[model samples]
Target: MLSAVSRALLGALMLSVAAVAAQAQDFPNRPITIVLPYPPGASTEQVARMIQPVMQERLKQPVVIENKPGGNGSIGTLAVARSAPDGHTILLTTNALMTIVPHVQTMPFDPLKDFVPLTTAIRGILGIAVNPNVPAKNVAEFVAYAKANPKKVHFGTAGIGSPQHMAGLLLNREAGIDLVHVPYKGGGPAVNDAMGGHIQAVIATVSSVIGQHKSGLLRIIGIGEKERFAGQPDIQAIAETVPGFEATSWLAFYAPAGTPKAAVDVLNRELVFALNTPEVKQKLFDLGLPVVADKPEELDRRTRSDLKLWGDIAREMNVRAE
Candidate 1:
């Protein structure tokens, strides 16, 4: 019933509409890959697996996790920043990789310009744990002991610019005590030394000491989180005695710059849903992490605020990469 020219025009418009609809519908046709800057078997990798299933269920596509660890997480982080802006790839990393690394090292990519945040994955508190042989039983006791002993109270950390190191510096500044800082290659080594009584204390994630603490091999003196963890109700918060002292580590999901808004939105919605699941929550809790599932704008704001805060901390302490 239509002439050739009219039919051609109608066909072109229909095709355009169909193309847009198809793009929207076929959003996750392929598997999605989440790149982590930490090695396998670490807390970050463990948490990634815990949530991957829930994300897959919500998105109806397989979510794969990749480990590309090195250079204090700078190597894999730069890889993610250079990745395609498509929704297929995502970076699951700690704030240290973005916020602390730039201040510590000469980076290959810009954190602010190279990526857009999708959502905050989790925030974990660091606990001050010590060998059971140490005399301190609480934060105040530890401060008093350290102050009395001075540099005799040796502490270990993952590395110089690591969150562990920053936490130690903050503790020194707040408690007005001088303690020797012994930097190790990673948390594993630092924790091992502490377990062997080679180190007096170490500021580390709760997950890193849950087993040892349960076995009485180590003592958790205080937590950085506002409230006590359900499993460790007996331990008091460091802030209770330190007065205004707190340090927490955060992990987030990010997409490379120029990623489509529709794609970012789709991923963000799925992540929020995935994090809200009971199974995901329990898994994170088991690892001593709390899910944050923030909106994109909220994540953006948090990132900027963290940058400013850490910048101040770095300047105040004169922390430099080694």
Candidate 2:
């Protein structure tokens, strides 16, 4: 006969084991929907398309990717939060949706608790690209020029609360310069405006700026990564000049809270397999994504850390809703 306290502890352990087994059994029986907060052509959308077939094959159900491109990604993200916890619907989005936008606006759901972490779907490096005729040739020169001419160097972004906008703001803070932010509807338009020489600079994803850099339409000043990119070894990271400076655009998958542990595990296993494929890896590399795959726990840690990081930045920089 066991003591009362020991009996209760033993019963709790059994219940926990039973719960784990039960969750693993009833997951992923139907179609899954991946909600993309950005438009179809965005990097996060592209990654969703890349992994769908792989996930479908593993889960034995078609994965549908739905585009909900508005409100700087809060609208779509909130939809996922309010969705059922059946594991059939997941929000696939960048850090901006969870970490940046909420600091600047009123959101419908809590970023920390409303969702279950699935995985970090992808990670991309940021690059500061400017028009060909900009006076600055490198990051140092660009900073100096912007310092000398405050509010004259026009920096365009997708919009306020966007990663690009935050990147611009972070750059301004680090460089101690004031560059006018020219917001656009999307990254494509922002890059177009920069290429047209309407804006002096744009902090965009490496993939978006690489082709233009190759075509001589824009000049690649520096990347916001720890090292040089494999595709473009000529351009160095911005951190080379500004120590402790690094910014990235990453996509992750999240299910509504209370999603079965089985479903999360299945999805995480399938996603990890998809990310390791040769074709997927090559495409991500070509697109300037660093191709980092994380476990659900790691993603949770990252999301929490980044939320605090960006939240602090938003407060310090006085970034407000547009």
Candidate 3:
């Protein structure tokens, strides 16, 4: 009972739906690669390696992890953003790259618009640690020492506009101290310098410096959390002394925008399932990454929220990347 043109439109719509369904069913015809936008041994890389095995088993495809570190994680992220939307290339990176860096540096792609968030792999607690030679036992002592020395206290971070950098900036604002920030290529190098006394202190993820702290090479003075993190209870919260100080970082999975919804669902399901497993959770915890397997929407919301938060912080502190 329909006109010829109307009938043809209906048929075309049905065919499009069928094609998408077929694409979903035939997804992952080839291997999938997770692009890690950070150097090896970073928390993001470590988290990706932890989930790679389980995800491979679930998807029944050979999963490969590729490390492409640069531009504060934008280099590899741009690669994934420009990749085909066939779900073969996934990006595993931190909030800083998506939320913080864009505000400071010109990005090749829109983070929120160019990528579909799959899931948040884990959240890490940031902490402030001092070299053994520095005279600081806790947040209060460190603040006093920094104030007394002024620019003499240098704090190393992963890089400019990184969560570590933001944490140091916030500490300066709240504690009224002047700790010069020394940006490094990555957290590993910063921690190494802190241990070697090349820098007086470092604001980094707890996991990145925990080993050195345990070995007595670097002394962790304060945890950048509202309360003491359950993972490391012995460390006192920086907020306890500074009042309302907190900073944390998260790593997440993302695929190029326009990837099939079916593929996104599958990846999210497998990732959430793998992270919920006790073995995987414990392993992540061992590396100072607490499991935070949330739905894709949750990651999206967090990304948007953090973008604003870091943007404001960067603007207030006049922090920019060149």
Best by lDDT: 3
lDDT of 3: 0.89
Candidate order by decreasing TM-score:
3, 2, 1
lDDT of 1 by residue, 1-322 (tens): 9999999999999999787668756887789999988888876787688878888887888999999998778788888888877778889888887787677767788878999989998887789899999988888889989989988998998888777788888888888998889999888898999999999998888888888988998999998877777857888988899888888788899998877778889999988888878988877877888788999999999889878877788889777887
- Clashes by residue pair, model 1: none
Alpha-carbon deviation at 118 in model 1, angstroms: 1.1
Prediction 1 global C-alpha lDDT: 0.85
Preferred candidate (TM-score higher): 2 or 3: 3
How do the predictions measure up, each by TM-score? 0.89, 0.90, 0.92
Question: Per-residue CA lDDT of candidate 2, range 1-322, in tens?
Answer: 9999999999999999887677568577678899988777877778888888887887788999999978667778889998988788999888988888889888878888899999997777788999989987888998888888988999888788788888888888777889899888778898999999989888888888889999999998998887777788999888888777778878888999998877888878888899888899889888888677889999999999989888998999788886
Measured by TM-score, the strongest candidate is 3
Against the hidden true structure, what lDDT does model 2 obtain? Answer: 0.85
Clash count, predicted structure 1: 0
Q: At residue 285, give the lDDT of candidate 1.
A: 76
Error of 3 at 32 (Å): 2.1
What is the TM-score (0 to 1) of candidate 1?
Answer: 0.89
